[model samples]
Target: MPKKAKAHASRQITLSELVTIQAGYPFRGSIQENPDGDVKAVQPRDISDLGELSADKLITTNLTGKRKADWLQQGDILFISKGIRHFACYVPEDMPETTLAPSLFLLRVKPEYQGQLNPEFLTWQINQAPVQRYFDNSAEGSRQLNIRKPILAAAPIAVPDIETQNTIARLYAASLRENALLHRLIHNRQQQLNAIANDLISHS
Candidate 1:
């Protein structure tokens, strides 16, 4: 028989206390894509509903002005604050020199809380039903619901011990991988069926 997991003590705290939330890079005017650009900018569409951020095919652009750039780092959490659906995703260690668009918020775990709070755990917590409901209720604007910076910073998060957090984060990560694999399998199967149908039509 498998060993049962032990429950760990947890405490509820506001997000601001755990991480420093910063607004995304404020790119001026229309985003002009440059294939030769050095930096890659992540847009709201680049992120999936399952908290996966695609680094491939991102908008590449150069900054001409004097605006300082804050590059996205590994373990960083990107949260969608401008859309009706607020989701959080963790930046993988394989990320390159990338910056997020203004529609998102960059959350970096505070140095003091870094050891105590895991980025993946925090990302998972932010996407949970209860926290999502909080965001949904507090979101403003008529045409499009938006979660203000203050509101996002003030959102509550349950923090457990580092060990427990790591375990949960690992499980969540595995689930995401499994989900992606299943999607690919389904897509390939559908393509196989389509190919068979096309062959039958040609034969007929």
Candidate 2:
């Protein structure tokens, strides 16, 4: 753990104790692009490397009563359990009624532990380099690495006071927003340069 993380560690608890972690429902049918479908499904690709959701790739489907428990809610976190790189995405309040794909693990803070653990903080913590490394090491499979439920359940998380957790989560969110703006700015600049180059070439 880094010095800053160590300083924040007022107490330690297994991830499972703080949040209920369960694998997503396995949808036997294909993920169709039905905007009018009853339910939206969040696939692994829908989560970006920065832990933000990309709605462009989200697919809609009809979920049955048995899978209602998989419905995502605000403050819920989705973990990419299978893949070369793992990502943790925090669900936002404005997201439509959505459910996770089979490749993800739904992380919901236990009601009793909700006051003690902030969902944003837990999601940010899991995305941290140290915790990511732990997941990387625990991941199984030669071609496609997959994190098992037991490994995630046993992983330790540092829990600071509620105030500190909120502050950290706020800072993390600000950084992500800043990063997104920077990316857009860079893309615009690149497009302008490409357009100018093409105009100059045409004139020459």
Candidate 3:
């Protein structure tokens, strides 16, 4: 008989165990058209497919001091709870003070487990294809799939050693930077093509 490969030892934990998941604030009333409003609220539309936040699309809100806790902080991971497409984005330290819309979930690592789990790693893992498929399968709603808090909490995660987690997170960040550069190159080339086409049309 052939020898079977042994599975690597790893700690498996439910997402809920590693982090505290909270639903985003449900902002009432219309968004302020003024860019200088008190708060910048992040909506589902502001999340890109690559789990990047589009700063230009964020809408301003009029939230007061009483709702200060509702504001997202650096290292906070925002997960799209409801929608056909899901995204998980890490809030950068340089991001302006912002609030989350109702359709998103804010995931923060438990204080005790912060050293064990990397925030960027968790975000990247949740956006992985397997995890995304899990969300798609568990989501509810007839018209549009909606991932509830419980569903997200129940998702499984592999907790590897801290060193491995850090390595993977660094690689993931590098990949994101590479992709962004590629996107910019493509966009610039397309603009050049458009300009050439316009010039040729004028000459003709």
RMSD of each: 2.3, 3.2, 3.1
- Ten-residue segment with the worst summed lDDT in candidate 2? 1-10
C-alpha displacement of 39 in model 3, angstroms?
0.5
| Residue-wise C-alpha lDDT for candidate 3, range 1-204, written one tens digit per residue | 999975546787899999999887755654455666777888888888888878777877676434554667778899998878878998876455677877899998899996888898888999998888889899999877899999999998888888878888899889889999999999999999999999999999
Candidates in descending lDDT order: 1, 2, 3
Question: What's the lDDT for all of these models?
Answer: 0.88, 0.85, 0.83
In Å, residue 123's CA in model 3 sits off its true spot by 0.5
Residue clash pairs of candidate 1: none
RMSD of 2: 3.2
Task: Tell me how candidate 3 scores on lDDT.
Answer: 0.83
Q: What is the lDDT of residue 27 in candidate 1?
A: 80
**What are the per-residue Cα lDDT tens digits for candidate 2 across 50-96?**
89988767777766446554667888999998888788999877465
Clashing pairs in 2: none
Indicate the TM-score of model 3. Answer: 0.89
